[model samples]
Target chain A: MIHQTSLMAIAIFLFFASTVIGISFYLGRKAKSASGYFAAGGGIHWAVNGVAFAGDYLSAASFLGICGMIAFFGYDGFLYSIGYLAGWIVALFIIAEPLKRMGRFTFADALDSKFNSRGIKLAAAISTLVVSCFYLIPQMVGAGALVQPLLGFPHYVGVIIVGLIVTLIVTTAGMVSTTWVQFIKGGLLVILCTIITIMLLVRGISTAPTDANGKASYIAKRGVTTVELQSMGTVVEPDGAWIGKKDPVTGDMKPAPYVRIKNAAGVVSVWRKDVVKFKDGNPDVTTFSETQATYTVNGKKNVNGLPRGKGEGEADLKPVGYLSKLPNGEKETGSQTPWGFLSTMQKSEAILWANEKIKDAAGVETTVYYQKPTLGSDFMTPGSSPTFKKVREEKFFGKLDFLSLMLALFCGTASLPHILIRYYTVKDQASARKSTVVGIGVIGLFYVLTLFLGLGAMTSGALDVSDSNMSAPLLARSMSEFLFAVISAVAFTTVLGTVSGLIMAASGAVAHDLASNVFKFKLDDFQKVKVAKMAAVCVGILAIGLGILFSKMNVNFLVGWAFNIAASANLPALVMLLFWKRTTKQGITAAITVGMISSLAWILLSAQAYKDVYGWDPATAIVPFSQPAIVTIPLGFLVLVLVSLFTPKPKDLAAVEKAS
Target chain B: MAGLDFKGSGEREKEDAGVVAHNTKLGVWLFLVYVLVYGGFIALAAFRPDVMKQPLILGINVAVVYGFTLIVSALAIALVYMKTCRK
Candidate 1:
């Protein structure tokens, strides 16, 4: 969708962006050493690192993706927020301090710390790179999605721009710059979203057609019947109705099968539907009016200022998400409390728009948005989207898939390479625990706020039917254009913050875990930093390409798959190494390798992959369901136990035990 | 033996091992609590979705309330762990 650029939006976006880049430059000098490059020299304040955790964890998936999901699918979207935040329990209580005590830089550092095995280093490093790559996709895709609206550029251009910017941020200063960027981004996102949500509550809900001249209000008044119509003869208005057909000269019915009228204003109205004959029909009934024209400027198609997404030329796409009917037959609900807003929305009627894809005579596919009147109560229930419908219906596959996805999310948080690395940035084990607590507090608050932000967007009267990713930014647009711009820029930064962290993890896997340990490169500190920087650039490019390819996917959904992979591959190895004395290096290597490969293969062969990636029938998929974690995670633990039982104990485990 | 055993080395090694054991025991206990609450919600969502849809208070349903409870409980558990570890 091509959006008209607002000067205010541009200025605010530039200001926030430049300040981030400026911080990276200032911190660049501190990141010259290997430890500083990868883990911020383990000197960052616990409080600062804590907020940075929130910043790193939130990502584009939490901000843009969750808000967009809730805006479109109601309460189903908030489930992701809940699952994500709950995952932190595993992080805080189980992983944080132990991880800090074990690792020097990367996640592999901790895993290999117990036995100092090359096989463990190789497998953990590969898992880290793969998981980071998977996580980076959604963040990059989110960056691409924001560009079309924020800068009036193509999606690919946006992806490339973000890739370059994030590469600079990562290569220049590594973890130090990444941490501070996340800190600022996390704080700003939470504060601004809160302010905008308050504005939504203050403005409250009102009936559409409140102002005739406003396009948003006009679309809201008409609902979804906004098609253009033309008459054979002169059309006359009877009883003040919007649609009319009468001959002005003879006062007789001049019905025609089809007619096109070209007005002097260069607007052509085509009434293509059959005209209905009146048989005691209400004259006050109105059909939506449409003005169609192929806009051109300077002999080229000018998509700028034109409505983007579905129903652009034919219909005036309005801000949707209003109560078509309220409880007690009230037309509108005034200002509502945070709790009240949710309660009222649950009981009222919202006009949620759903899109249908139709092919024209010329075989050009276009999406048409239809108004769906959903009860507030039904909207809050699960199983609205295909993702959760089976679970909501309590079917066997649905239940299993739901359980599997939840299990992955619960374990994935502590196991994620980027998140685990954050533990190393703090000073000590105590600091790690304190920082995790702070992170949990900040992230928990922001997630609660997303519920309102999403519901606000749902009824903001400004929804783009075809795109779920744009819901939050468009909701901001409805409040004020300038606010939309600021939020969009912040949302873009959300992507950058996450991608930079993911890239840092991947680069560390390459330089420290893979090259230095696995391949026995034995580089000095300066050389290690150089290799990491080069690795950062390569990973950044790979993220950009994947981001553009997966542009249409809902970011939160992609993050779910990534979570499953991470949980399956990394968690068992990390957990057993800490708790189980019999866990051998060979067992750890086997667990990571089998867990990673099996989950990846399962996902690639899953029904969702069959439909989305291969464009094949979902029924042809080999896997029973899309989420692989329910099977793979337990498989990881089992593999580790069995293998460890058979293998000889490592001499290093005893040595480390005595040294510690 | 290099004189490096958590059980045999010295008082400090014994203390460190005790701390590790304590941490592991506490971690498992908290994890079970997490499984009951978080896992319970997922089970309820799959098997008894209608129960989740039932109204709880002020027009909010059981699911929304439970979801918020999970978030709040996570924070509580974290604080509890932090305090216990310090002790």
Candidate 2:
């Protein structure tokens, strides 16, 4: 896909990125001390911190991935929004005030607050690094993904660019700049998305060019028509369609088109295949391509990539929202109320796009999109995704997978190193609680807007079926180029805000939690800040490297794994320390170590990993399901409890005593 | 402990401690409610997707209504937590 660089998008993205860097340098003076660098001098207003919390929490996964999921899959995508927002309740009610009161810089501070144990510090610092790195991969991946469209840069170049920019932001002012950056980005995201949702509502549902009886109308052709051509091997028909090349071995004409394909290893190959019909009786058609012969004006084809309406593409993608029937038996319900829109859509026809990998006559594999007209209610229901289908089947492992993922999402927010650190940004426990409430409100509202943004994009005819992450941005572009530029720029900032926070957490874990506290490095405040800056640079480079490596995975799916790890590693100890009087430092250490290792191993060995990362049969995986939180979270709590019961009591018991 | 009392007022410490205890009890109770509601919703989604697809008052299904309700309830509970716990 050769992306055309839009000057408007470049200008807007540059403006936002530069403004963020300027703010960082301006705030650099305040970050001279370790305390200031790690915790923003603990003086931010609760309200601003609250919005910043939203900003930090709403990463590329939330904005790009979830919207893309909803655009492609329907209600399944919005499930992520609900699960994410619900996590804030844990942050607010369980962790917020306690974390604010106990911790100074990192999540380790809270655990080690009672005993000041080096073992506890070491375990927690490792856990923090693991979780932060896991989370960082998706953010960096999203950054790379954004650059392809916004800057017309290659994926690795985008990763490097984001890494450099984020490192600059973090090394300059640390939390002060990070917090302010999040605040602005969060506010803009929610406001702009809300405006987009309103625009979608006003535009409402209309007849697509395909739906209307026009030159490009496919309304008459419902199911795919099977066409067989004469066995013309290696022949280009007068109609411009390529035919199968002759097999060298058999000297027989085979109906397979030969095309060159580049694999992940960057090796180009011409793969060979012969057509074979499946038992289902469907023809083994490699791909479907209908040339826009009628789209020519004055012997010139229409401008490529100028959207469906004006381009050589099949139909004009108009505002398509509400339909009257399940599939095209139409009484058109035009514009509707928010409630009306959803209700009408439930009974309407939704033209969803699906893709399948096809091997041409040459073994070269490519994905092609085909329209699948489905009932709106069916599209809006669960089980549309292959991941969630087992739940609907009432399968035990499938249900467990669903439950574990949800549990991780519900528990992960409070445990995330970056989010826990935000509690320290506010002045006091009261401010922490207040900010949490505000964060929940802001984040919740934005999640609601995602439902509209996604569904609007679904029928907006602007979907790039090949890359689901670009759904929301393409939806914006369909409206106007200017809006698309602004949306893309803000989405890029979304990546920057999140990656910066993760780097900050990783750096704090290394320098403050590990070096100064755990290893007893006798570093002064200035030296600590210096060490942290160096750590940030290392972590930033590592994130960029991993981002490029995991370029194929969806950001939302990657975030789910991050949540599972965070919940498994951190939640049990934090909850136990605060609520249970008997929680020992040894227990916290053991729990963190065991929980982190177990969850990480479980994910690496899970079925999804076997299929996606390792390219093996999922059935051969050791774990029954992919998500690890259901098993690991309980294991964490059990380890903490049993260890505490067996271990000697802490000499100080300050945390328990204070609670009593 | 000494560093914790930043304001250096004994009365303030006592009041702060009292607030913490009060907030803890309320927070725990509220969290239980949230878990029950949210957990129940997830259970329904997993076991009975068909039930979730059933239309509620509007043509809107049970899933959308419940999801929106959860969002609204989170905001409402947050406000309630702040209101009752505030000094």
Docking quality band of candidate 2, CAPRI definitions: acceptable
Cα misplacement distance, residue A527 of candidate 1 (Å): 1.0
Q: In DockQ, how does model 2 score against the reference complex?
A: 0.36
For all predicted structures, in order, the TM-scores are 0.86, 0.85
- Taken in order, the candidates have interface RMSDs of 8.5, 5.0
User: Candidate 2: TM of chain A?
Assistant: 0.85
User: Can you tell me which runs of candidate 2 are displaced by over 4 Å?
Assistant: A1-3, A209-221, A224-332, A360-362, A652-660, B1-15
Q: Write the per-residue lDDT of candidate 1 for residues A1-660, one digit (tens) a residue.
A: 335666676677778778878788877866688888888878778888889999999998888888888888888888888889988888877787678777889989888888889999999999999999889988888888788777877889989988998999999888988988899899988898889889878877664513222454534333213233333233322121123346766888644322234454444333322233567875544454222222333554322124333453533444456667667777667777877877778887777766543333444333445556688878787767657877765348657887788788888998899999988887777778889999999999899889888888887777666577788888788777778878888888888888889999999999999889999998999999999999999999899889988987767768888999999999999889888888999999999999999999999999998988788989889999889999999999999999999999767666786786
Q: lDDT per residue, candidate 2, B1-72, as tens digits?
A: 122111111111224667789999999999999999999889898988989999996789998999999998
Tell me the spans in candidate 1 whose CA falls farther than 4 Å from its real position.
A209-216, A219-316, A360-362, A552-554, A658-660, B1-15
DockQ (0 to 1) for model 1: 0.29
Model 2: which residue pairs collide?
Answer: A256-A361, A271-A362, A271-A363, A272-A363
Lowest summed lDDT window (length 10), candidate 1 chain A: A235-244
Report the number of the highest-lDDT candidate.
2
